[model samples]
Target: MELQQMRYVVAIAETNSFTRAAERCLVAQSALSHQIARLERELGAKLFERTSRRVRLTPAGAAFLPAARQCLDAAERAAAQAAAAVGEVRGRLAVGLIPTVAAVDVPGALRDFRQKYPHVRIGLCVGASDDLVEQVREGALEVAFLGLPTTVVPKGVNTYELARDRHVAVVAPDHPLAEESTVDLRRLSAEVFVDMPAGTAGRIQSDLAFSAAGLSRDVAFEVTSADYMARLVGEGLGIALLPSAYVPRLTGVTTIEVIDAPSRAEYVIWSRTVCTPAASAFLAILGISTGPGTPDRGPVPGSSVRVAAE
Candidate 1:
């Protein structure tokens, strides 16, 4: 019946081991077992089926699990609301960013967010768009900036489109197509291409464009970093297709617009189920309005101009 006991039950159910659950709960195994036993006795039902090999929730425990989680979430939200009422945004806010998020003024946003809510601890994690999106869905991150194709947002997440940039082709200055203002993708079908690995947002967009043109590219190299891709293109190793924002400034490389390329859209995404005060504050700093659900808003004030993605 106690919140602590509920936490113990939920942790034990999740971990499936008393020893591990006790470790997670920061309590002795004996004490955790005692509490669970007490709860079972009070409820007049066995909540868990424990064996040496594994632990699992019994019928009653399985039925009670969701309510236990709801109670914990409600309690946390209540505490956060109380803190917000006092205009205090104080908690850990884990924000995820793609490796090439230079389009957003992340540092400046963080600086202003910290200045306004000094007690809010911020943790930034850089990752690929897919991985970051999964983390947001799993509640591992409060929010993230991701580069996505024109696709539906994940079911449990809400996204606000931040910006969109056209995909462009980069090549050595001496390359035949370098002088052109724009070129058709079909013209480059025979050339070896340097590109991000498959499954990345940039790579997916490039693939779609090529597929649309009924062309296939010879991928000479698969790189993860945009800067490295630029370096390879600058060395004349291979031509590359990248989001215009990720086209690096290099003396030997020239970027030309892809005449019929698919554009990459950058979005700010978060779980629809949870929105902490710190997360809300960060969104506000980015010029997004947080309400009952996700709202479509404009760019961050003074950040409308596009910048090269690092």
Candidate 2:
């Protein structure tokens, strides 16, 4: 029932090790176990199934975990709200970024945010769009810049469209398709495609576009980094479909607009939970409203128009 007990349960569930959880909670192993036992007794069910090698949550624990996190988040938000009431925006803010987030001048934004709130700490996490979305959903990150499909938005999250850029084709400068101002997706169906690993926003869009066009690309090289993909294309390894912003300015590579390619939409997404002061300040800098009832600013001037998702 105690908030500290909820904290212990969450920590133990996340780490899956009572020892590590105790370390994370900055408490002794025995005392942490004692508190958890008390909680289980009060609830009349065991929360964790402990073994010599590992600690895992029981079904009861699994059901209780999300509620525990919600309680903790509510408490944290209450504290943050009290601090915000005094016009203070000083706290740690965890922000997530996907690899293809080029539309937002992240460095410039961070610099301005730091200048305005000198005491607020910023932590940056970079990952694939799906991973970043999941992190935001799980409360691991306060906000994330995600490259999502135009038609689909995750549930229980608020998203503000930041920018949308068309997917383009990149190839070696000497490649035949490089000279063309715009090439059709069917023309490159036979060409070797260098792409990010499956499940990435760009890759998913590319796959869907090709499928929609009744074409299949020969994916010869799969890389996780945009820079590496550009390098691979520069070396004549293969061609790649990438967000225009992610195409590197490399000497041997040439970027061409794809005639019928799908566009990827970039969004700043966060859970609908109460906003932290730092998150609010960052959103304000991006010209977004942080109110709960605020609607999505579909596409602003200077932002690329998004195509319907395939």
Candidate 3:
């Protein structure tokens, strides 16, 4: 059977509905049905059992699914390698970025990347670190910028340290702690805190920071998005502990050193098993000594950016 037919089969298996699969694959439902029928005829077995409400893969289809996926992955990788050889890196590169990075580095980085590799089509998605890591594992993203606790790399992917951003206490300007150049964590022992939801990388770090001081966090609210947390802090909701680099200078919000808060490391992760030419080119752009890549190579002499707080 042709690769197109295999694609149809895989899509159908994923979506569990021919109409939905056809929509995702940008083909007509009739065309997808015909292709699947052709594949079934070639294999001499029916691949799916469809009823009014459900679609189920037959035994043969279930067994053949992995092989079909491998075939498609191999074919796509081959095409990407061939395109790279001609020095034309033109394909879709799906990238995942945590919200902070998306808000800060992405604007300038994309401007440079697009100018340098104009032919490469880039898709950007923003999510939490854990969600982004899962996306890379599932082939939804070719590369991602993740804020993780340890250096434990994602399975089947290579990790490159990108930059280190510090965690700081954010509060409203003109608040009690705003004018202080820096303050220890204990100073806010009684204040309510706005923090990331439990089990997230950010929340874990926040917990650790407080735990180290023999204190438990008094969370005023749990939030999922960094931007939302920042806005909440700006509204005088509560003190928020977040990466210092991403805290916007909102009119009422102020950021100060959380003396003992944990510093977070951001990493660039890409699948070792899947390398597209467009992904490779984007990686190249990220590898250069400029942009977000520069901060990882230790600190430069005369560089204004602080890698760590003294």
Predicted structure with the largest TM-score when compared to the true one:
3
Off by over 4 Å in 1: 1-80, 248-252, 300-310
Error of 2 at 259 (Å): 4.5
In candidate 2, what residue range of length 10 has the lowest lDDT sum?
A: 301-310
lDDT by candidate, in order shown: 0.81, 0.82, 0.75
lDDT, candidate 1, 225-283, per-residue tens: 88888889888999987777765544568989878977777888877888889888888
Q: What is the descending lDDT order?
A: 2, 1, 3
Off by over 4 Å in 3: 13-17, 20-28, 52-67, 102-104, 134-139, 150-156, 173-176, 179-181, 249-252, 289-310
Angstrom error of the Cα, residue 48, model 2: value is 3.4
Question: In model 2, which regions exceed 4 Å deviation?
Answer: 90-92, 118-123, 127-141, 149-156, 173-182, 196-200, 208-214, 221-225, 249-252, 259-261, 292-310
Per-residue lDDT for 1-310 in model 3, tens only?
7999999999999999999999999999999999899889999999999999989899999999999997897787677777788877766789898776522255565677789888777888878888888888877788887776643445566666656767888888757888898887787777888888899887887777777888775897898877788778877888887777666544458889876767677677776567677776676655423223433343334322233322
Which pairs, if any, clash in model 3?
none
Q: What TM-score would every model get versus the actual structure? A: 0.71, 0.76, 0.79
| Local accuracy of candidate 2 as per-residue lDDT tens digits, 20-64 | 999999999999999999999999999999999999999999999
Q: Which ten residues in a row have the lowest lDDT in candidate 3?
A: 301-310
Instruction: In angstroms, give how far residue 205 of model 2 lies from its true place.
Output: 3.2
